[model samples]
Target: MKARWIITAVSAALFFGGSLLTSLRDPWFQNLQRPDWLTFEFLIPFIWIFVWACATISAIIVWERSSKRSRPWYLMGIYAAIALLTSIYSPIVVEFRSLIGGLIVGGLATVLVYILAFLVKPISQKASWLFLPYALWGPIGTYLTWLLIQLNPGVS
Candidate 1:
């Protein structure tokens, strides 16, 4: 009950912060060699808002669907891992200015998104479905990181 709500609130807050991990206005980011087709910078925050909203709702659904006899600590841990991984990605890339680091973190996050979706499916199909956007975004983000690495070689 109350605990579920608290967990949901915390998840939402953490993901909201994760959404803002990368700064579009940062000089380094602004100077990156982006592809001409990548023109949706302004939509990133909104896209993350939608993704995190889905993730939050999915977590709640999973929580409600779990049996009282067996608490959903595993799911909680997975969610926390994914959220934390997502949060640190931008900082790591920005601080080190390393496209390689970004690519690694992004790929890892994508894998975790798939793992989360797979784990959630058994608990609640609807909840798993809710993770679809995040799952899709994960690969897209990873691809973007890889592209950046390709565009800007020798980026330390």
Candidate 2:
């Protein structure tokens, strides 16, 4: 349906748009110490694209199948919270250069994604599974962020 597509597009746009607005390029980020295993830096954006697509689709599935009163409020509240929390990552991590802040915000984002996954399950199992990748990846991201913070003590 058109609504589903619209939601997906808008969700994707909001995520990527927020990234554009908040993302910063700095020598600090570039020069930060990373393990040899963490060398695949070029794939970060692509991974985010995939994760957002999955989360968006899952949210749409939940919205379509849930009660009529789920729109622009209950669902939107969760979605908005998720978006806002996610958007907080770059600013705190890059702008303020706060390691603990990044960990906390990233941790919150992970929790929100899990909550989104749970919210979709009452609607569609398949849709719920769509968020699985993100759910699975969130902790990994949080861990890596923590490690990066630990590994690089001089990023600020």
- Number of the top candidate by TM-score? 1
lDDT (tens digit, per residue) of candidate 2 on 84-114: 6676677787778776787887798889877
What TM-score, over all chains together, does every model reach?
0.90, 0.85
Question: lDDT by residue for model 1 over 16-53, one digit each (tens)?
Answer: 57546665577997788987889996787788778877
Model 2 spans with C-alpha error above 4 angstroms: 69-72, 154-156
Model 2: lDDT equals: 0.75
Cα error, candidate 1, residue 20 (Å): 6.6
lDDT of each: 0.80, 0.75
